[model samples]
Target: MTTGIVLIILSAALLHATWNTIVKTAGDRTSTLGLVALGHVIPGLVMVTVLPFPSVESWPYLIASTVIHFGYFYMLGQAYKHGDLSVVYPIARGIVPALVSLWAMLFVGEILPAQAWYGIALIAVAIQISSWAALRHGVGRAALFFALGTGFCISGYSLVDGVGVRLSGDTLSYWAWHSVLHIFIVGFIALRRGNAIRALPRRTWMIGILGGIVSMTAYGLVLYAKNFAPLGAVSALRETSVIFAALIGFVFLGEGNWRRRLLAAVLMAGGVALIGLSI
Candidate 1:
């Protein structure tokens, strides 16, 4: 990856972490995630008006991605409900790069050199290290499973979008259509909650919507990066969001074990540097 691509992916990583932090701190994770999904819908609506429709070839990936994204959001909301940002976020984000990398090589044939592979391994290890305190103390069986589920959802979408954008011939169009599906997913959740959507506070609504915007932009950047860089490298770099999420958990959410998390963040930074240099 070029320096420009690295910077873009890193910016996306930060934004991704920011939005997840927002979700983790929300009053009701499910509802907040719904609002976040709504955030994707508004921009998607605008894009649909101006952008050309995606090609027939892209539709399969788009449809599959939409279904996968619904599951992703569900798993994420549940994970945050049952675990802290620092604990769940690292595991969830940590596992994705390796899975995405493996999928890319086996299915997409995007090969990475040994150096890049080393960087990916380093990043994954650092992320697991960051979660050591929680793991050592026991994060509860429920939270562990939910977090793992969230990671699986992330890996699913990463691979789907990696190919989906390239096929669409218009990156923005693919992103818009993929995001618009959020409406159905969020609407389904809202429906199940009855009139609770109306009862949600204005602040919660605002945060969710804004966080959704950030989340969309973050992934949009990643999709663009994938066009320029290897999918595995891009995915691994994006997982740096776990470190950012850890800091957000520490500084904002009042989570503990900052010393360990920060140390892990430093190691993760080195791993990212290696990935960038190797690229």
Candidate 2:
């Protein structure tokens, strides 16, 4: 990958970690996510006016992606509800590269080198290490499963959007439409929460919106990077957000057991570097 692509992906990683931190810290995960979804739609609404429409063939993929993304957001909110950012975020983000690699191989026939596989293993092990202390102290099974579900949802949507955007023939159009589609799903969620929208304070709305914008921009960068890089490599590189999340958790969320979590972060960073270099 070029230096430019590396920079873009790294920048996206930071932004992705930042917004996830916001989500983990929010008082109401579902409502905050709704606000973020609204934020996502604002930019998409603007881009829709300027960009060409996605091809008809891309609509099916777009619809499928939208459903999968909704699952991702819902599961993520549930995960954060039961777990700290350091643990949940690492598990949720760490497993993505392996899952995405498997999906890409089965659906798109993209294969990574052996080194990349080793890197994936390292990342997975790092994620396991992240929870070691919690396990000794009796972590809840619910949080583990929820985080795993979140990871699965991430892999599902990553594969869907990878092919969806490629088929759309316009990255910006595909991205914009994807963001716009998030609105309906979030709306349904808000409705289900019963008057949740009215309960959000001004400050929460601002934070949620900012998080939404950052989330949109972060993945937009990844989609753009995917156009130029291998999907697995790009996904692995982005999972570096796991490490960024660890630091954010320690500093911002006041999470404990940082000694081991920091070690896991170092391993994850090494794995990310190996994956990026393999590309």
Candidate 3:
């Protein structure tokens, strides 16, 4: 992967983690996600209105991506309801790249060079180390499982959008419409909750709005990157988001048991290094 694309993906990853951290700090998955999702729709709707619509070939992929993204948000809401940012966020986001790598290989007829394979392996090792702490904490296997489900959702969207954007021939329109549907799904859920509109806190709303903007930028960046590169490289670089999540956990959440977290961090760093060096 070119260094510029790698930087874009990693930059998006940081923004992704930043938004997740903001959501966790609020500690209200239902309201936080609901409002954020609803607010996010506005930007996408505006974009789609101004931009040309997606081509016919892209519709299937775009539609599929929308459903997968809904699943991602739903499972993420459930995961947040049950777990902390340190544990759940890593499991949710950390596990995606490996699976995406596998999908790309199995279905796309693409093969990673030996070095990229090692980089992927290192990332897996890092996730395993951090997950050990979760296992020890009696972290609900159910939550972890849900988080993994969320990971699959991530992979699904990545693969679908990877192809979809290329077919759509307009990355901005593709994402704009996809975001519109996705935000609507979440908004519908949020509207059902009584007082959801009235109960939103100004501070939390600000954080969520900021997060929404970050998320839009991240998704847009990835979509644009995929237009000119392999999905695997984009996916691999995106895992760097987990690194930011780990740091966010340590500094913002102050997760207990420093030793295990430190080990996990080292493993994640080593994994990224191995992947980078192999590349």
Q: Could you tell me which 10 consecutive residues in candidate 1 have the lowest summed lDDT?
A: 77-86
On lDDT, who's better, 1 or 3?
A: 1
Candidate 2 stretches greater than 4 Å from native: 77-87, 138-142
How much lDDT does candidate 3 score?
Answer: 0.75
Ranking by lDDT: 1, 2, 3
* TM-scores for every predicted model: 0.94, 0.91, 0.88
Segments of candidate 3 deviating more than 4 angstroms: 130-132, 256-270, 273-279
Q: What are the RMSDs of all candidates, in order?
A: 1.7, 2.1, 2.5
**Predicted structure with the largest lDDT when compared to the true one:** 1
For model 1, the superposed segments whose C-alpha errors exceed 4 Å read 78-85
Q: Please report how far candidate 1 places residue 54 from its true position, in Å.
A: 1.7
Highest TM-score: which candidate?
1
As a TM-score, model 1 comes out at: 0.94
